[model samples]
Target: MGCARWARRAAPARDIYLTYNWKWNVDEEICGICQQGFDQMCPKCVHPIECKPCVGECKHTFHVHCLDQWLLKRNICPMCRVNWVIFRKFE
Candidate 1:
């Protein structure tokens, strides 16, 4: 089976929750966006941001403000060039 099909089949049963051990106090060392090592701020805007890893299907995580600016120029994801779908709900 193809990777995408495999991912789709497995996704429904997978738990997406992220858990951390607060006993070690490691939150300060992790990046909120990519959930990896500490990321540096953008020099142009002075906003902290994490760069997505090169290998992945959905490596499009970014700061809301920074990504908004980026999306203005292109509709596809910066890292993967995959078209993004926007959904807005009215409450």
Candidate 2:
């Protein structure tokens, strides 16, 4: 029973670890507005928000500043135009 419970707990942790640690590549996660890698800043902005926002469905990422600016005019993903505002993951 203890082993089974540990396995259940470990599975999600492993999945999350692999999902982020294994699959995450800085080269691929470029900010659309700035065209910079994850480690870089948005060109139009001076200060950088540590956790960037990603649209969950299409997996497009952006700086919070850029996304918020876009949201002011339109409530959609800049890349896919998929009615964004919700379903976004920041970090």
Tell me the alpha-carbon RMSD of every candidate.
20.2, 12.9
| TM-score for each model | 0.33, 0.53
Reference-based lDDT, each prediction: 0.42, 0.63
Residue 73 local lDDT, model 2: 95
Q: Which ten residues in a row have the lowest lDDT in candidate 2?
A: 18-27
In the range 25-75, model 2's lDDT, one tens digit per residue, is: 433477786677666666665644554656535667777777778889988
| Best candidate, lDDT | 2
Query: What TM value does model 2 have?
Result: 0.53
Candidate 1 has a TM-score of 0.33
Tens digit of per-residue lDDT, candidate 1, span 30-89: 333334433444334452323321211353344344456666888766656787443321
Clashing pairs in model 2, backbone N/Cα/C closer than 3 A: none
Query: Between which residue pairs do clashes occur in model 1?
Result: none
